[model samples]
Target: MDAIFNYLDNMFAHLPKTEEVVRAKNELGQMMEDKYNQLRAEGCSDNEAVGQVISEFGNLSELAEELGISNQYQSASSEDKFVSVTAAEGEAFIEKTKKAANKIGTGIAAILLGVISIIFFSGYAEGTFSPTLGGGEPNKIYIAVGLGLLFILVAFAVYLFVMTGITTEKYEIFEKKMVKLDPHYKLIIQEAKENHRPVLTRKISIGVGLILLAVAALAVSGILSEDNEALLISLVCVLLATVGVSVWLFLSGGMIQSAYDKLLNEGDYTLERRKSESVVQRWASPYWSLVVVVYLAWSFITADWSKSWIIWPISGVSFGLISTIIHAATSSKQ
Candidate 1:
């Protein structure tokens, strides 16, 4: 009996909650219960009686029409319809956007701290700040190391906080099966896609432009005199611009991708797609953290600030190979 109700609950879980739907569910449940009791009284086994009741009651779509509640059911389906976005799903989307924005913002903040740390460390290493302040103080070296370590710790903490807050189960349905949307809802989805196409292109272009501008600013700063106040000022401006563009891209792209996901009922947000990613592919945060640590350690130990930039490109390619190998290994295991 409990199992029977559980099955019914699962069936109706996707539908919107409304007075009409609730009343219809109650009436149907009562009918099924009555029929089950009758079959049991006639000496049918528990399983047989429950099965008989379910078979006689039929599926919701048929029962809804029979009960003259088809219109209500259709309305609920239409109102709540999105390929992957239900009430809970909508909330999850919003939460995910917030998380991504926070991560981008925090990551940029951490990088800015790293830049400041580098300035301090470079000054200490080269005795650049000695004339202005005093003879090379040991505390300057300690401050440089301390700032570098603090940046790593703070960045890691932000990653942990954002990742832990995500509720993976909210997206589990996509792994289990595809959602079937009504024809009317499908048309709505199609319209949304078409309308957003131009906007998507524009947003992507703007995002890329901002990123390139930041890179150009950084490059120019690197070529300038180390003691030039303009170098520090330009770096600060680049950091602020990068952070602003990053946040905008995270939020805007997330919203657009959410609509696309809802339209197709598939994508990275779906469990099926997520499962296809290798464990190494999912360890992006940790991998990049390692890169950061190695970059900092190499620069500090060798005081090779000029050559340290090479580490980024090397690590980038290495990560791709590592992910490919892990993907192959996992695929073979499966």
Candidate 2:
């Protein structure tokens, strides 16, 4: 029986795992096992029974018609160019994407935290920089330290973003090209995404709630007197912190969902969208690179860090419009 099973395994080892091939393998495996058992029961030795089964079973090519995988067995591996993924690899990719999403979300949140630290440190230091409280040195020391930490945190965040991309580079094929998912793994992948959907909704809801809470804080702050500088700054910092947390929650949920989309070729990663986005992708890399250059150049040249950050928010909003217009134009042309 073991020998018969081993022989069956070797026979199908190189075959493309089309649905027909998989079904054929199972049906043939059962037949082979039954035949081997019948021979053994008839007083034949193990080796003789295994030999008889192998001889009778012949090869996959000969039995292709009976198994209904004749065409698939002959041409699938040669003609099909779509990528295939193993169940183990698919699960591992999902887990890896979750970790990357968490890391990226945390990094984005850290940038906001860094901004809060800068404002808080400078505000606190400047207020107490008098001769009686501390000295004039507190202002310089506080601003310098705050700025230093901000740059360091930003650098670390960028490093994480880059590393995640590099580590997952091999899986880019799923995004760049169509994937012919093995029938055996489709149910597994669908089950995983379905299970993860509820959690995704919860995370997104929590994120929206947090953003609303941040907005309410600003309203409360605005209602109070403008004379209280410390109180105003404190409320503003709280708002930033709240929004950072919301962004983290949103990205964490979105990233995992994006992983499922890539596997299923649905949502933003659909085959049609992927084909259309090839044009947008070409524009995106340089557009962002130019934005970064402009941001840094304008910030340093004007010596106005506060207003310079507004470029990010504006660019972000405008890019959505730009991409949408591009998508519509390309889609309409087709």
Which candidate should be chosen as best, given TM-score against the real structure? 2
**Which regions of candidate 2 deviate over 4 angstroms?**
1-81, 125-138, 297-308
Spell out the clash pairs found in candidate 1.
none
Tens-digit per-residue lDDT, 141-252, candidate 2:
7768877887888888888888888878778887776665654355456667889899989988998898688768767777876566667667767777887887788888
| Count of clashes in candidate 1 | 0
Q: Which stretches of model 1 miss by more than 4 angstroms?
A: 1-88, 91-104, 114-131, 138-149, 152-160, 167-169, 172-199, 218-244, 247-259, 266-286, 303-334
- Cα deviation of 318 in candidate 1 (Å)? 6.2
TM-score of each: 0.50, 0.69
lDDT, candidate 2, residue 217? 73
TM-score of 1: 0.50
Clashes of each: 0, 0
State the TM-score for model 2. Answer: 0.69
